[model samples]
Target: MLRHFAHPKRLTLVAVPLAVLVAVAVTPQVRGQQGAGAFESSDEVRAAIARAERASKRADRRAQSLERAAGQAEQEAEKIASQSAALAARIQETEAEIAVGKGQLQLIARQQRALDARLGERREPLIRLTGALQNFSRRPLVLSVFRPGSIRESMYLRAVLETTIPQVRGRTAALRAEIDKSRALRAEAEGVLRKLAEEEDRLSLRRTQLAAIETRKRLAARRRGGEADRQEERALAYAEQARDLDGLVDRIDAAGALRDELAELPGPILRPTRPSQARASGTTTRIPPSTSRTVRSPSGLRLPVDGRTLRGFGSVDSKGARSEGLLIRAGAGAQVVTPAPGRVAFSGPFRGYDRIVIIEHPNGWTSLITGLARSDVNVGDTLAEGAPLGVAPPDGGAIGFELRLGGRSANPLDHLSR
Candidate 1:
């Protein structure tokens, strides 16, 4: 076995391209796993990530297959075009041959017409010679010896017969040759016409196949364009909503008068319209809620993060300050989803917390989630359970959450299904 060796510069170039390909291949999978908090367990999140990776790989393979088919179609189109060009040239050549044949036929017709004219002019002379021969035959041989004019005329008639015999044979042969040439010209023209028709049919079939390929390409391009547009619209909407919430939260912090106003909210909460569907009969239909394991789960709460719980409720921090919530370490830039269906009460940058989001739920339950890079929801916006709320920060950062009932803090874990 021979050891393989490569130049350093060549290796670098090849390696860089391969690395980029690997990264591009994994991008879709990572994007698919953005909202990590939506899953109840870390195992489920991992499974989803793995599934997304496999799907992306499958999509890449399918894309490669399509590219191959497109290449093949292009090659076939080029080949057909070449064949059509050749056939067109051949057809032109055949037409030229047919034209030459037609010209030859016209020449032959002219020659035949001239020969017929000459034969017609000789018709009267031949008739006169016929009568003279007949009269000469009717008299006896001895009678011609006694008649000098008859013998001289008979000698002149014999001399005319000797020359005319060869001329007639030559004219008949020339007329027959002209007729044969005409027949050959007609046969050649017919053959060229038949071949041209066949080539035209082949050309039509190739054009149809090329048209079908073009149609599929156009349809696929339109579908991809529509998907890209939808994704862009969603991103823009999210960004705008985040900006509004940040402004609102800032106003509430500066005022210090919104607390009393926030406490005076109505008791009844409006149900979220999300996950609702419309029936074909013009009626609204609601999808069934997920099954809950906790029978006495007053808040119907779910854990918002999957990291290790660092501190419990009512715990003392390093600053000797009693914490009103739980502190948990989560993945960097991981997605934060709403724990339960509720309306957004507050979302903005807090004094100590980088960013915070508060959701007001039914039954006097309110959740305060803090330490986000940015929030995705706005105050007064109703959210479905497990909907995206914000993005968690990176650098081994921890998130803080508080579950408050009425005015007192409650243990968030106590109401969780798991």
Candidate 2:
């Protein structure tokens, strides 16, 4: 019986399958024995999972926020005169969605790689076990009795097979589960890709719409003649004369104040037709109250662009120069809108600040925005609150917004609507 058990063919058939099963069962133990230097610990795995969950949550929140902002901008566009703002908002929303989709695809890819690694860990062992099992099944039981072990040895082999077979089955079940998870991840990646394509399509549509609206506006401005040109020339002159940004703001403020004063002046008085009729009228002449529009505070003003503030009002920069306005880091080609109802005092390039816009609001309030790649509105264009002023630089550049009351810089955040 010992000689039969030691036969090369019998040993290979029994030993190979048994060794494969043993390897599969003790893989975790072997890995643990290898120490943390060789493999990740349980704590490390849990931390990685936690970070992935946090990133997914943040992506979800950002997508929701962009959706809400897009809806709000669409409503505002319907109420305002300019449709470019809404189109720009839509384009931004689509870009954000596409970005989120790409991120999700990357995450799915990571999960697939992990699953592949896990499957690889058991793949060779499972294949060996399967081949050995097939060989044993193909051989006749009566032939095995004639060629190898005695009845006692045969019974011992049968007992080992009973134990090992069940373990192999369990391991295979776990592998199937992992494979199913991998399939699900692949499906999820496909879904994200489809969404990304849809978003790209929508972005293209919005860009086309915005271009058409901008073209119409330009044509209308041109038809209005040299008045806007003259105003822009005057604003350029002011920009040239001013030594610094503050000086330019002061000059614009003074000009606005003078304009308001001239508008408020009374027209020539008219004489009454009859002296008796004039006498019958009240002797006391009552002056009408000024009807000029004004905002007492910036409490209800919208932010010029949707972004995070890189530098707040009064913050010092690398140059040790205090910030007079908010330095916002916005997405590529983000829409810039008027914060309040105002007239365009200056809209064009100034110095090295790229394209800039200065909006003159009522009651000595002024808004200055800089770092635009393009300016939609010209000088002397009257705009309602939330009207499209322009777009930020295409490469996700930073833009500056300064709010001044009576020629003094103020924190825009302090008065923004909650």
- Best prediction by TM-score: 2
Q: Model 1, which residues run further than 4 Å from truth?
A: 1-299
For model 1, residues 28-88, the per-residue Cα lDDT tens digits are: 1111112324455545445544543443343334334434444555555443333322222
Compared with the true structure, all predictions reach lDDT values of: 0.51, 0.69
Candidate 2 per-residue C-alpha lDDT over 341-403 given as tens digits, one digit per residue, 9 for 90 to 100:
789999988889999999988777899999999888989987754567888888878989999
Model 2: worst 10 consecutive residues (lDDT sum)? 30-39
User: Considering every candidate listed, which one attains the maximal lDDT?
Assistant: 2
Model 2 residue runs over 4 Å out of place are: 1-82, 92-96, 99-162, 168-176, 270-295, 298-300
Whole-model alpha-carbon lDDT for candidate 2: 0.69
Range of the 10 consecutive residues with the lowest summed lDDT in candidate 1: 27-36
Model 2 TM-score, 2 decimals: 0.64
Instruction: Report how far off residue 372 is in candidate 1 (Å).
Output: 0.4
